[model samples]
Target: MQQIIAAAIQFNVQQGDVEANLSHVRDALARVADRGAQLAVLPELWSTGFAYRTLTELAQRTDAVVAELQELSVRHNLVIVGSQPEPAGDNRVFNTIHVIDRGRIAATYRKLHLFSLLGEDTAFKGGERWCLAETSLGKIGVIICYDLRFPELSRRLALEGADLICVPAQWPKPRQEHWRTLLRARAIENQLPVVAANACGLIGKLDFFGMSMVIDHCGEVLADAGERPGEVLATLDRQAMTAWRAQIPCFADRRPDLY
Candidate 1:
């Protein structure tokens, strides 16, 4: 059976402190590497937290962040996935996810759905495209925090041949239940594995609940980090996923015409 070990790093992000946040992520990467993880996922806006008031000043160029992550990927020999606020030309900024594989940038996905409640729509430009990166492990799709609430986006990725999905989030305390429920729902409905890396502690006035998790296609919680700062590692069996897909055949039985 083909299997891949993945880890989600849950940590408290220091708001507006890029250097400190990057240092924290570097340490988390080491921890996951020590745990024999081939893929390490970091929380959304991990490098700068939710410094919305100073987003423009804190936002880094995409190339710079990718270069740093590339070096880390090379050193650890692992794929790393994380989101950052990046300048998008025309005085605009985008919440983008970068996927680095073996010292190279594999793909990038800009967050399509912005959270209006947090004034994200006013602050950042939403992406118009979906991104799925082909990697040594499997076909991986990327999505940000708010995107998790939309089932159609996940379904589109699954329909387009995604075996696994990674979510980088900064979900707040009040909506903790929604975060957990949506993650499992995406996994079960699409019959694919999901790895969600969420931020912990406080950022500005928002308190983040770190419940980073990995769920199997059957909606089984394989690993959960709870409301703490740490890493949760789990192995995904591609053969088992294939077998389940064959048995259930939801994708094949889809009636798009009727809909």
Candidate 2:
């Protein structure tokens, strides 16, 4: 991983309003570019926020949405990470994250773990595999909202030589502490930098408290977005991550056989 400037875009997501949502992302991305961000993370299902009733229709527009993202990535010279509803066979949509690295579609990851409490399993198709997008910037390991609760997925990414992790989450209230702690824990344990983007404000019946964070390998909070619709910027130093890893040596001493 090279020393790079990164950002997280946290905003109030109006469910089912693709135009409005995309507009917000575009505006935020331009500001992010102005701030010299090389990589930016967007919230999960940002394009169309789980409008289950018209999900299939929304999923049909994913290609166009991705094309726009690719263009924006090129315009900003940034690696953008975000999720949208993807059209799956059998009328089900998969929550898929697209990693656009400066005009190229670096990787597309489907959400492995569905949030059953919110009936996500019933509305969407679960992914069978994970993704690690290798870009010019770095190997970006992506984790959706619910996936944060599962350490094994992230551990696999770390074992696979991911330099950093990007989490695009729509995690809401009552579990704010879980969101913050798990993000830092992932970085500390894996000895990798983390960029997490979360949504804020009310969306339908649910109220989201955005606490998007950029964390270093030693679990230090580099930048916090707070509980509002905004963007947070941070500069990640790869040398710092390497130094911390050498100091702790957690990955080198992992007892895989014993576990």
Candidate 3:
């Protein structure tokens, strides 16, 4: 990993309106690329924002949506990461993140943790394994919205030598502090940069407060898109992160056996 400008593209996703959402994404990504962003992260369920009743039907169009993303990635010369619904057998779907690296799919990560508070466990299936996208830029560990609460998952990614953590989320209100704090905590503990994109505006009866962020290894907020539909940009410096890790020496001092 070297110095790279990363972007978190936060926007309001019209429920079940895949075309509208895709149009917005296409324009946002074009601007992000124009701003010299090598990597762009979009919110979870970006194509269709948890339209539970029609998820399976909506998932049928994922392949086409991904093809569009590939075109954008190649045209802009950027890496894109975001989650979408994947059709599973028996009328269920999997919340999967597609890591597209300049027109090629670098990795596909099925979200491991399902948010039961919203009845996600009943509606969708969780993945058995985690994902680490090894792209030309770096090794990026991908995780979805609710997965941020589980420190063990991020620690596992750190152990796998991930250079950065990419989070695509639809984090809502009444727990904005939790979203902000946990993102930084993951970066601080793992000694890796974090680029997280979250949605903004009201959807259904829920209010989504977008606080898309980019954090450094020491947990410093490099960029923040506070409660709005916009993109946050930050330069992730690998040399600085490495120097910070060496100064702190936290990863080297872990004592896992005693526990």
RMSD in angstroms, all models? 1.2, 0.8, 0.7
**What residue pairs clash in candidate 3, if any at all?**
none
Q: Write the per-residue lDDT of candidate 3 for residues 1-259, one digit (tens) a residue.
A: 5798999999998999999999999999999999999999999999999999999999999999999999999999999999999998878899999999999999999999999989999889999898998998999999999999999999999999899999999999989999999999999989999999999999888899999999998899999999989998999999998898889999889999986
Q: What is the lDDT of candidate 3?
A: 0.94
Candidate 2 matches the true fold with a TM-score of 0.99
Error of 2 at 82 (Å): 0.3
Q: Please, what are the lDDT tens digits per residue for candidate 2 over residues 1-259?
A: 4698999999999899999999999999999999999999999999988788999899999999999999999999999999999989888999999999999999999999999999999989999898999998989999899999999999999989888999999998989999989999999889888999999999888899999999988889999999989999999998888888888888888888999
Which residue runs of candidate 1 sit more than 4 Å off their true CA positions? Answer: none
How many backbone clashes does every candidate have? 0, 0, 0
- The superposed Cα distance between candidate 2 and the true structure at residue 177, in angstroms, equals 0.5
lDDT per prediction? 0.89, 0.93, 0.94
